[model samples]
Target: MTTTSPQIVASADGTPIAYESMGDGPPVILIGGAFNDRTTVAALAATLAPHVTAVVYDRRGRGDSGDNADTFAVEREIEDLAALIAAAGGRASLFGHSSGGILALEATAQGLPVERLAVYETPFVVDGLRPLPAEGTAEQIRAFVAKERRDEAVRLFLTEQVAVPAGMVDGMQASPAWPFLVGLAHTLPYDVAVCGADLALPADRLAKIGVPTLTMAGGASPAWFPAAAQAVAGAIPGASYLTVAGQDHGVLHNPDALREPLLTFLR
Candidate 1:
């Protein structure tokens, strides 16, 4: 049955966390990666709506969510997610992409009442796959945002952090919405911190993760991303891993390509 989406004003760390809910089934909360808002992954929610309830939210400082002057941290993000899950009536499955995947892993580690999880390409960098940016880039990005040069900061992040092709970066630079694209560049560090220390966590820590799990990677995704997904799957007991054909870190942009695989695995 079709259901209209409604915004829920949830409180997290005194900031208003804006979220949207749709469908009616076992709740499935969708958390987006850095700089992406609730609507950014709306397509994926629509695809999942028929089989499972999908709750999508804007993390603090992005989309309709409120921002705080305090430095951003993964712990704060976990709280934001907890509030959303509480608003959803306590327990729900989780699907996270990129940085969002790391957030899901952390939530599960802390035992957040998630029934199951599907984590896609967290970019943990555990095996020297993709190197982090040089020391000065973070400072440079902060400066760009402080000067209100959002696009330039975003360009640096895409070209340096995500390692998107130079041509693609060049193309996006000329797009009319480049400014908005970079508006959240200040949040890049949050993604980096989530995957910091090369994500070299010991296996014993993951062994205690007593929940059904699905680790996903994009078939056409970069090798580094698949590597991290594989690492995560291998570390967790009884976790299943799969790659969605023709999907990438931008899976929300190609929801139809991933929906079937995701539904089959999660359900």
Candidate 2:
């Protein structure tokens, strides 16, 4: 499972979405969370490629994907996923992480032709384990990006929206990945929209999703993570729920632990 030639498809609004596909058999698209680009899930894509056709792509405002920022809408991103699905042979399974997970759920609810679906820590707030995102949080992120304070935008999203510890955020800034995350700061609002400002589990919308689904979280993550995953699973009838042992929000960087679990559900 190696990197393949990059591909691009025009979304409903004619925004070009760049993606790469590897392996064969049934197709499964991998959608990353906030600040992620296609490269963020490249390793996970590679791990799953041996079992299925794994497609990884840039969301609207990230990586090589073109964004219509003036007309940004969650529907546009759904349309983007629709185009990717069409390219994925009219229908495909989906595996989404964090905000991307929420996006996948929204797409399914909006009537996208997805097969089996899997989401990890969709980041919903349930039972008040974590407070809902404050109103105008997305606007604040947009304002930061507008002022070219990309680092501030990233920090705000991680600390306020994602609830990452300030110390951990500081550690991240010293890491090489911080720059890449900052480079995608403009998309933080898009992720916010994907999760919604309220951050409540969209139970009514999720009820519309009838496909076989899998919801998961890391055992080591904050209590809210599992609660959010469970709430999502409960909303989607018959959805399976599991907590990946010894894992946390950073599971994206450790694809191996997820390989078998995903392949089990995927196959």
Error of 1 at 206 (Å): 3.9
Model 1 scores a TM of 0.89
- In model 1, the runs with Cα more than 4 Å from the true position are 1-6, 197-205
Runs in model 2 with CA error above 4 Å? 1-5
> Each candidate: what lDDT?
0.78, 0.90
| TM-score of each predicted structure versus truth | 0.89, 0.96
Candidate 1, 1-267: lDDT as tens digits: 113344756566677888887776889999888778787778898889988899888877886678664775778888888888888888999999888888888888888889998988886765777766666766676677778777777887777667677899899889886766777777776776665533454456567677999989988887888888888888999998898877878788888977887788778
Our tally of clashes for model 1 stands at 0
The C-alpha local distance difference test score for the whole of candidate 1 amounts to: 0.78
Reference-based lDDT, residue 210, model 1: 79
